[model samples]
Target: MVFLLFSAATSFAKTPLQPILPLLEAMPSDLHVTVPYLLSFVMADPLKMAMVSIENNLSPPETLQKLSESLTSLLPLLSQLADIIPRDALLWKLKLLKSGAAYANSRLHAVQAEVLFLASGKDNLLPSGEEADRLFKGLKNCRVRYFKENGHTLLLEDGVNLLSVIKGANMYRRGRQRDFVTDYLPPTLSEFKKTFDEDHKLFHLALSPVMMSTLTNGKIVRGLAGVPDQGPVLFVGYHALMGIELSPLYEEFLREKNTIVRGMAHPMLFGSKYETSRQESSRLDTVSMYGGLPVTPINMYRLFERNQYVLLYPGGAREALHRKVCLMSPYLY
Candidate 1:
């Protein structure tokens, strides 16, 4: 879904890769041909870049060489994409699109929901401390969990956990002992062992595995010392890098802290909750079992009122596509 948009919009946008004029000239007018053609090219570059990084330890010359090659390769794909949409149209939209909410400040004070501000200290797109502080002050009831060393994608980054912050403290005072722990059932011991062994092997090969160390202000956090041992905590944070950090973040929390974060996902994830399908999909089934509900104000409110821990990335797809450096936010998200 994202790659297709990238292909169509790259010609006019300030993309990392430049357009390939020859490929553009050769492309058919049909989008069907263009999408797969671009996809074919996208598949190889990341692995190639990773291989170069691992082999050369990301030395400047080697890295630049790989980058140049990758960009050169992308020319054909972008050229093919430009056939479907004019570069000028994409450029115009990119320039005019609002990156954030303009009227949020005026409306936020009217919100009665207890706010949990999860701020990333080194966030690039938004100043984490400043934004969190602003929200904290604006809202009638709010508490903050500041990660001094993390960037915008704090949860996705290594060594951070939702459980680490919300384990003990009664963050919100809801009268009933609403135990929605059943909404999040940790994987069985056997299931966990199998998943861990598989993920350990996979991430090592894919990410060039490294030990995770949670730090606060350059000091190591050994246990739940930084977190309040409590219930019904909701974590609000920004999304980054297409929310690529989610799987690792969720996996780590389950593995180390024995907690499952009920991620409030987009409605698309559940495949039309209103409709019933006789044809079962393994992918959708797995996601449903993982406890990803459609995002709604009611869902969030109920979770908090019930004393269940909830994780939210409010930025949606816009934030994920807001790329800057290395498909990541420079110095932040």
Candidate 2:
């Protein structure tokens, strides 16, 4: 098992080892541990909790009755496990969890390597959040991502998208170093559908914007017919009122022009503060997936060099939130 795990870690082309809850489930399935603990740890009242989860859109409709039925089914299997496994074996496993971290703490500082610590806020089984902070302080190159509502088994839970987390952290790269432009991943068809149909569905319907373009002769035309049918185009516009204009602008180009606007976005959108409280899916993720790069001179240059359509907001927050001055002034700031 150790060899296989090591091989799996090394096979990924120098990706660092991620040790998450090592030996977490190695306990022998004795009735004392499995029967009572498993039942209470997850579902004290399976049917009731299931109903609550369903009502909150956390689980499917069928989960209510089905979960209760599943719990009943677990009894016989747990009984079988109690008979098969020794009680002392289970007790020793329990002992390990109590002392495992303390044992590892002294040795951890000796190992100098990059670490990504994922802390679960509601982890019932362990003090994950506190441990993560401790590890972050001790380790040289450690970064932490906290999942406040998640448990120890967050990977198997619903709405936990790992790729999105990695992307939001700006940790996606092909080589040793990072390159924002070359490393950016465009939104897939599924992502596009989700963003339009699910995320911004209401906004798209409410606005139903009318797009128009003008020619060099000052002749106006309906739709994007007058717009260039090529790349390297820069669309500069006012960021009116909390950037509500962004959605339609991006969507219309996608729907009609078949273009992904590489908007030079502010760092605030991609910062850690946003990720700490974000749950399940986020519009910020959508922004990044749709080619929203950090507002920097190099990023803009890169987009133009690649012959990609670019979008920029010169005024930024000053224009979006405090628009009265921008409205009165003939010249844009």
Q: Record all residue pairs in model 2 with backbone atoms less than 3 Å apart, i.e. clashing.
A: none
Q: Which prediction has the highest lDDT against the true structure?
A: 2
Top-TM-score candidate index: 2
Ten residues in sequence with the least summed lDDT for candidate 2: 1-10
lDDT of each: 0.48, 0.60
Model 1 clash pairs are 124-332, 167-229, 167-230, 168-228, 168-229, 168-230, 169-228, 169-229, 169-230, 232-307
Measured against the true structure, the TM-scores of the candidates, in listed sequence, are 0.35, 0.64
Off by over 4 Å in 1: 1-186, 208-225, 272-286, 323-333
In TM-score terms, candidate 1 sits at 0.35
- Tens digit per residue, CA lDDT, model 1, 176-225: 33232333444455444433455444853675433244455556565443
Q: Which stretches of candidate 2 lie over 4 Å from their true place?
A: 1-40, 43-100, 107-116, 132-144, 214-223, 268-285, 323-333
TM match of model 2 to true structure: 0.64
lDDT of 2 by residue, 1-333 (tens): 000000011111111211322333443433244544443454223333233323232256566566666557645654565556456655565456346645656566665544556566665555566666565566555556677766655554544556665665566677766577898877666566656776788987998878899987889988887788787888897876777877777888888988788888776666554333213335665677777877888888888998898998888766777755443322234
